[model samples]
Target: MATPARTTQAATTRPVRYAPHLYNDDLAPVRKRTWGTYSIFALWMADTHAISNYTFAAGLFVLGLAAWQVFLALLVGITIVYIGMNLMGHAGHRTGVPFPVLARVSFGVYGANIPALIRAIIAIAWYGIQTWLASVALVVLAVQVFPGLSPHTTNDVLGLSTLGWAAFGFMWLVQLLILSRGMETIRKVQDWATGPLVWIIMLFLAGWLLIKAGFDISLTDSLTDLPASEQWRQSIAAVGLTIATFMTLILNYGDFARFTKSHRAYRRGNLLGLPLNFSLFALASVLTTAGAIAVFGEAITEPVEIVARIDNPWVTLVGAITFIVATVGINIVANFVSPAYDLANLAPKYLNFKRGGLISAVLAVLVMPWELYSNPVVVNYFLGGLAAFLAPLVAILLVDYYLVRRGHIVVDDLFTDETSAAYYYRRGFNPIALQAFLPAAVVSGVLALVPAFSAVAPFSWVLGVGIAGGIYYWRSGRVRTGPLPNEVIACASSSSTPTGSTPAPS
Candidate 1:
């Protein structure tokens, strides 16, 4: 685990090339700023490339869209993810801190806890879901590795069969061991896992389809397989859902962005990481999924399943090993690490990053992850609900940072609980921020839950963002305002570029 580091004076005084918001008393800034656009590109490989992700993307077939329309929908949806990632990237680059500490800025010194916990809870839920999904591959791999284990598949207990329990435990223990080592280990492991996973899957997809479909199919097959009615529904839903899915992560991205050497580095990383990386992965995913249909005579959404269809033992073995590694990368980054920072943010005094993350990882086993994935319908509902939480927070932050503060932040005042500090808003919590969050979240939650609102409910995130921003502007008045200290000013002046209220130039 990364031990905390002190804030260097040069961090804020220079051209703000360093991570600003992330440097707290307890956590040190990442000493080496070695990650670049390509690292970020690989990071997305880890983020978006996964067994669950392929399932989710191809699940668009349920929306009744043809494969081509589904592809178009995916393109539109992920493009939004691209833009959202860019916005989130700014926070990371400007602050040089992780997510939880940076929340102190927009959420209020104490008020930040609410958003942090919200994000943490969402991360925990996903941790369970991702773990459950990865267990699918684990079970497949186990049965292949040790064929005698198959008899245990039917032995049911506590909803899951004995084999299911073993697989879940296998994934659980592996994640625990990986996570306990801390962020550095996670980063290096992620870089290694995602690259090979992609290569093997691409190879598997080509060879599988060439054997069955005679390599006659193209990536555009998904476009041709669409159902007019369902495809349209899913296409639009995918757009909104994609935005909602990635939007909250966008707001809290400073959790990692605080590590960059320059804002330029962050921007370069995001551009490579999001749109370009996401789109290409999505395309490969759909093609393989379609190829699975031709090869196996059943529509296979899971990549592990597609590889399992291979006849060669060595090919299947390579696919099995890569699947395990890929799921590890996705689960930790998208789930484990995020919740760790979130819970730590909630009670910085009681739970630092490692403890917070540990609590989340341990609790995941207790959730009976199998129950979480028992019904995909139930899973989507939870995702929609979690998407509701970020709206109000996003609205308040955008309004306060851009319209109110005009993209400036005071570093020291953020840490100090002193009455004189800029961030210590009366009694160390900002009611205005709270006011924005409650109503927006409640309404969005209801919209997401109710069947009547299904059409627009996928848009719950955007609705929440809009509602929060408008409410903050409407209610905004008479709050004290002033320029931050010389240090903040120095950072701001140095990073200045011609722009509007971006709050982040780099």
Candidate 2:
């Protein structure tokens, strides 16, 4: 008889032979779910303690609301994200597949590409934006350290300056090198870049600013006070924007959840990582910027600008490097990884993670994100538009997995185009799901873009989810064909092991 070790090895290796059109090592179900609670916690630590988040959080305080009101709004928004992440993460933990593959359960194998491409486009845009944000720090440092380089910052080629291009290219190359080593390397980078260093830096910045301001700062002081109705409206808008900031991650959370060891671990990780951690970081941002108003005679939302004003090279250098590292951590985890999996899902036979990631990076440069980032109107439009697009997709996937399918997935069928396969709907497209998603997305999109409906733009995600999920649930009940009874099911219960076809962690 074969030894148990050999038998286990055979079981794990066998699934690698799934259809070439869907079977690449990067796109395959992960064999080992090794990421633990701390890794999950660190993932959020990396995501939140970045320059963009700092600016975003700081911007919230000036929206004609008290600090406590902003916090309350953020609490509401973040709680929603925590719940959405858990719901989105469950299918990945059970099936050990990425977002694209998990999407195949509801969208047929070929039609899954629609959501995948949509997500990829969003990631690519943000990747460029974050890269541009990080490069700004480099420009600040370069001008400070080498005064002669200050002129190079002004001669704009296209939209960015000569120095801006150099800094952006350098940051891009650093990210590419880290990504070339794959997920483990990215996780390791996140662990180191974020954990304590970022928190320490944030705290130090807040403390120093408070000292410079003689501890005289107020969170209620707004640039322009508005009527109570306007205050409430903007506060609600703040909540919506906070939720919008996370819609991309909320939709494709399986990209991280697939690495988690158990459903319990995934929940524990998201609990610590999202609401609690994010709240503290938001507090730090508000405190630091409020102190800046007292000291600088004007409110400065940019941390790099605050750091630049201090007459200390060592402080500036450390701040720049830490911010850059923190920004890079989030960029790779949130932006780079999503598109890599998404693009690979488009053509698994021709592309894997590295190649897909490379394609994303190339597209990042072509988008000229600096122009997009500089315009406030464009940024808001971008956020509202993408949130509308993402919300429907997220709703469909969550409803199909937990309610409709009852937490069961025929993992093998997700890879096959066989006529009899459970997921292989007409020409590899699920008409019911498509019917539900299209109308909902279109309505949400139109509402966000139309000037008359501008008041509802911030709540686009809510609108899309309600419309899409409601329609899909009703349509799914009417449909005769669903999951085949005889196929292998990845057990959804927390207590039971997944089917034996899923390889156990070695």
Candidate 3:
């Protein structure tokens, strides 16, 4: 892990004057960089080792492709994600800014809130759904271990059963406690619980399934029965969907990458985390699904369902609790942390990290995500809608940072509301970027919603990104620039705030 840089008294003699809307300790550049390669690795482990990821991998097997074909597609898709993340991580690692603040360099100072709120809303939805999923696992375990409790499971309250409410409320409180402690606690939980323990349970679960199936599992059995043309087409589409799964993280990776010690450390961590870790996870998921099919004569995509089917009480209990813990780790890293920073970025003066997190948690409940997840049509619509906005936003950021500005961000100017600041374009809005985003987003949304274009929906993120990025690059004249200017370098050297600020009293 990276060590904290010592703060010189000169750097902190008096805090720099900052606009009320633009500056807070939480939104400031990190002074003491502490995350290293393993933290990044563990982040991916936490994000990917959940019920949703497992189901996504198992769903790929049903796409009529051979196992080798699926693996190849995964490799290609993940490599693209790896490249995109490295590009996004550069700004954060160098400047010590979160995603939304980094976005101001491209979107303009106040305009950054548009992308920030959009990403935060998406995080809120997923946060509720993942917490609900963990609660469902708890419900399953409760029913199995104590059959007498089953009688009380169906008493309805607020669209959830009595027992469902109990489990959901419990998980909700637990997440709040974790979030209350802040990011360091989240990092430690993920680094320790998610990386090793969850993998062990998953391996054990896969082994049990294989043994139960007489060790005759085969991922390609169903695919071999399909026509060649269908297999090839579905394989390509599956790769697109796989890429879409990580689109949210790809856009906001700077939220975590900002804590890294260096760009080299960031890249090394992603190399191990994205392609390598994902491949191993996909393999295990496929094996587990094949085993389920061999034993039960039907594919079981959900790990919770697979655990519940086991007759051994002890095994079922362990699997259920492990999955609950895994979901919490993922929820904290992927959902909680992103919005905590994103929402805090929206109103820096009043809402610090903890208050922002509390707001996200409350909104998660208000959104009634349980109803959304229960309906397949609603889930698809929600995810498709998110893709439309997210894709264009990511494209705009990449184009502005890389091609337009030549990766030269004046860090101090990012927080200043001064009319002369480079980022204060047209009262804190970039017309060129908005022009690029709106049309591309409309086209992507149409492709996602229209049945005639449904086949193209899987690649909606790719299409939006490419279209918006190309348009922005064409409209914004390319400017070649070198390292930070002397003034910007001096500002960076002189500001020495702590990494994560102590939350304001609630």
Candidate 4:
């Protein structure tokens, strides 16, 4: 095991020559780690406070479990996510590298691109879906405010109506503008604007529904007609699904954590953002769903649908706009940022952050995510498949960082293409890591896709994580406790050896 080195300013401040094929400003260690507790807190706020999250929580309530049972599941599942996020985040905070760059330690400098592309593809799918979701809210508001637009909503073109296309285009443009401004601008927007704005709207909507329903809402009331045994089974399934929902973020959490000032700050933000914030959001979702049922005579799971049913046009408009903002916020943080860094890592010489983001955006549009999201069967298969691949990757990463390497990565070797460098195993690829990832991912994918293993499908993420982590751990042989090779203790101790300097050829 590599010994943990002393924290050093030289890691960030020293000037080191980087291989042209391996370095870019976006992939380098951050010189100024400006993010604090609130930034992380707000990041989760934006990520969790979205239409999809609201609907997912509301859908769980309709599974016939008592409110407390669902909450218990949420608490447990989110707690696990909290722990995972901390592990991933701490690595980035300590190493000062983004997710893809960090992966080079385990996956080999070049092999890391495989996982990076996989993650980037998933992000693109999500980016399109989220962008479409946000647009729906705008379409709803536009048709309500201007009756003339109703025709355009029904006149279909390329699977979407004219109004839908317009809304999607508008949303796509807005997100592009924000992303072009860079990560700091995104952090500021989430922290000060979208995060707080959505919370207020959610609280207000829940209160209004409660008051309108005559305060008769009860979480204990069964919403589904299923048998009690099946309800419990479904409840358990919901726990897994809930975890799967955020697995992507949990895996790449280091992307955001690298910007954080300290481990404590990251944990503090996660505590507020995951468990506390998510619990409150879940409660609001349940209450809002129950209230909608009582008043509307049917369960309205979608927030946009609920808002549309409101008699007050002004209030409805506000709700629509808020949902748009919330969805956009989540899309940028959860989907856009991950791929931007991942794709940029693929070819640092050619692609910078902005260019990578643009590629992702274009691919998102080409995929026509609206079609994928509109069909429930497709959405399930797509998300399940994503979990299958992602699960093993997460497991491998955790094992490599926490167990094998012992949280000690040679910062300079991460940017070197030389065969002698620690990360450049076998011509810049680690066959061991690939061997571990492939079979695990294949088995997990089979479980998700095969009907015989359908019952086990929900737990695909957990299963993958376990299988991959175990395989990597066992295959790597006995753990080593010696100090890491080429480890830089601190900036002051080793100013001569810059963190980005290229290593001599083997």
Q: What is the lDDT of candidate 2?
A: 0.81
Error at 141, model 3, angstroms:
1.2
Residue 341 displacement (Å), model 2: 0.4
Each prediction's Cα lDDT score?
0.67, 0.81, 0.79, 0.81
lDDT of 3 by residue, 320-344 (tens): 8888999998898878888998889
Q: Would you list the rank order by TM-score, best first?
A: 4, 3, 2, 1
Clash count for each candidate, listed in order shown:
28, 0, 0, 3
lDDT of 3 at 6: 31
Model 2 superposed RMSD (Cα) = 4.8
What does candidate 4's lDDT look like per residue over 461-481, in tens digits? 777888888888888886645
What TM-score does candidate 4 get on C-alpha atoms? 0.92
**Poorest stretch of ten by lDDT in candidate 2:** 1-10
Question: Could you give candidate 1's per-residue lDDT for residues 366-435 as a string of tens digits?
Answer: 7776787777888877777877887677667757765666555655445545565556676768777778
Candidate 2 backbone overlaps, count: 0
Cα error, residue 342 of model 2, in Å, equals 0.7
**Candidate 3, clashing residue pairs?**
none
TM of each candidate vs. truth = 0.86, 0.91, 0.91, 0.92
